[model samples]
Target chain A: MELLLVRHALALPPEGEGEEADHLRPLAPRGVRRFRKVVRGLRGLGVKLDLIVTSPKRRALETAEILADLLEGESWVSSHLAAPPSEALLAELPKEGRLAVVGHEPYLSELLVWLLLGDFLGQSALGSLEDRFPLKKGGVAWLEGEPRPGGMVLRAFFPPKVFRI
Target chain B: MRDARAWVEHLRAHLPVALSGKDPEGVHQVRVAGRRLRVYLDLLGWRVLRDDLRRLVQGAGRVRDLEVVLAGPWALPQGFRRFLEGELHLAREALSPLLASPWTAALLGALEVLPPLEEGQALRALGRLEAKAKRRWKALSLNPSPEALHAYRRALRRVRYAKEFLGLPSRREKILQEALGNLQDLEVLLGLLEAFLSQGADREVLALKEALLVEREKNMAEALERLGLA
Candidate 1:
């Protein structure tokens, strides 16, 4: 089974205005444009997904839903792919068919590490000084190989900046 | 033949004996008793028994899978665990809503029909099961073929499924659940068995068999106790 892990596009800053409103923050305009470009790139690479799964979080779900419409498959909202998706969730993914998951950072990066190397490396392994991994909004990682955890071989890592240029 | 009282009494009396018996005939008998009781429960509108039977069936289903794991030639890779769990999650999600449907109610309702214990019918079935179980035991004791193991597992599953359909008593669920746990351990043994078969008889295989035998005895004891045979 092949898996394509896509990070959701950039969102409005959490610091703006009220707490509840921050949770509802939509993607930034540039983030939207960047996501479209990334989607195009995915299409360019001929990634045909059998299923599109996204975090329940709004931004991630929206991004996945859009992609699901583009791809010939059903889209599901799963907390399993959400930020800090549990080991149980990781254990639950199907082994057959091509799948795509769109969600936020930290979790996405952790998932990547967990898939590539059977262990979750937290934030330190992302090669960034900040407390978080910078999988810029709309970044995409193309992984290939068996669906088993730690069985994935990284094929490509496409950052939003790369798509921007 | 359709008498509910007679059906229940016969099932109650025969089930324990069949379960405790050493041969496949006994196992088959126990299974028959379970099925008869389930049919009777449905006929008599025994809701509680029906529910109990459902739980028993679920537990038995797990045991059945375990049996395949134990007796089958192939062992699911560790990665497959994650895949299975994921599939289970998806299945549960899909099945949740269907649980409330009338079809489910009707299926459960079908468990209450109590067929007549007419002349040795139950006994014949039980006898067949007991004989099968004995044959399996002998095969395992002597040759330990994969096919024998698979048959043994299937017999255990039949027992479990029957219990679930009957919805016997509260303790039945706990006992069945424990038996299911034993089945899982047996599945691990099966995996080892595959390893042994594929790798050929060696010191490691013998060592694994010894360890597995110990575990199997413990699990079997637990299962027998749970089934109220002990």
Candidate 2:
């Protein structure tokens, strides 16, 4: 399986008076414009996704929608992506093809290390790993292997800038 | 100045107990405090620490949802029970550090010092909340998916809380929220059951899911009636 871990694009700060207002924070107009170019660049690099699983948060959902639009992939929202990294997230993977998972920071970074090392790193070590392999907003890391911890090899890492270029 | 300060104190008092994970009420209270404060911030138009509070609430919510599931009167399969326990543990593991971090204290400090809204601003806040609730209720009445219903419930809650803050009549909002809260609980349970089924289907889990779905439908009807949308 080929997996792409993509962080959500830039979003407006939360506004208004409810939890939905917080959850519904959409991508800023600039984020949409920039990510469109990033998606084009991914297409230019021959990236294709069979499915895109995204966090239910609006920003990440918007990011996945963009990928599905450009890459012709099916998109679904999963709360697991919005929460902590867990075996359940791994278990939820559809075992057969290329997929893109779009979600938030720190969680995505933690997940990246978990996948790379086959297990969660200690908090101290994980911080160092995050520093070493920071996934900026709208960045993506591509890996190839079975969808299990330590089973995949990092194939490429692209910041949105790389795609815009 | 609208219970924001009280909620800050509420959160502070509950922090240690919640971090201990000894009493579920601690986390529950913390979640409540965080939510109340968020609404106050929105109404007062205070921008500081809103995102921080949101992250805290979401983290606590993951733990609280599992706690509710585990405490419910259901005959969960042993495997499913184990899975819930594992999920709850992971959620707590994720939430504990955030609650313990200095940033949380900073968030609390900032919330404590938020300037009070003016007299007219209080009425404006109430007006904004009323508009939001009406809009959400209208949308849900049109298409009451489980997700839409859940979103509607949150809007109702905001109205209820805001009204209370402003010392206005809020009993109607509270009644509606109670009807919706039961439905939301079943929705969370059904979601977990479905996710467990994804791993591999067990006959018992399937049966439990069917039972829950039936209950959810009945509750949905009651909720719609309560909101006069039936």
For candidate 2, list the clashing residue pairs, or say none. none
Error of 1 at B24 (Å): 45
What residue runs in model 1 are displaced by over 4 Å at the alpha carbon?
Answer: A15-22, A120-133, B1-230
Query: Model 2 in CAPRI terms: which quality?
Result: incorrect
Model 2's TM-score against the true structure:
0.59
List residue ranges in candidate 2 displaced over 4 A. Answer: A1-165, B1-3
lDDT of 1 by residue, B8-115 (tens): 454345434433322334333434454555544433332223443444335333333433343444334444434444543443444334334333332333222222
lDDT of 2 by residue, B1-230 (tens): 35566777889999999999999999999999989887886677543345567888999999999999999988889999999999999999999998887456545644554546565887787788888878887888899778889988898898888877777889988887886787888889999998899999899999999899898888888878776778
Worst 10 residues of 2 chain A by lDDT: A69-78
Over A42-138, each residue of candidate 1 has an lDDT whose tens digit, in order, gives 7777878787766645566446644654566545445566547466565656788888878776778777766776645444554342234356678
Report lDDT per candidate.
Answer: 0.54, 0.81
| TM-score of predicted chain B versus true chain B for each candidate | 0.39, 0.96
Cα distance off (Å), candidate 1, residue A131: 8.2
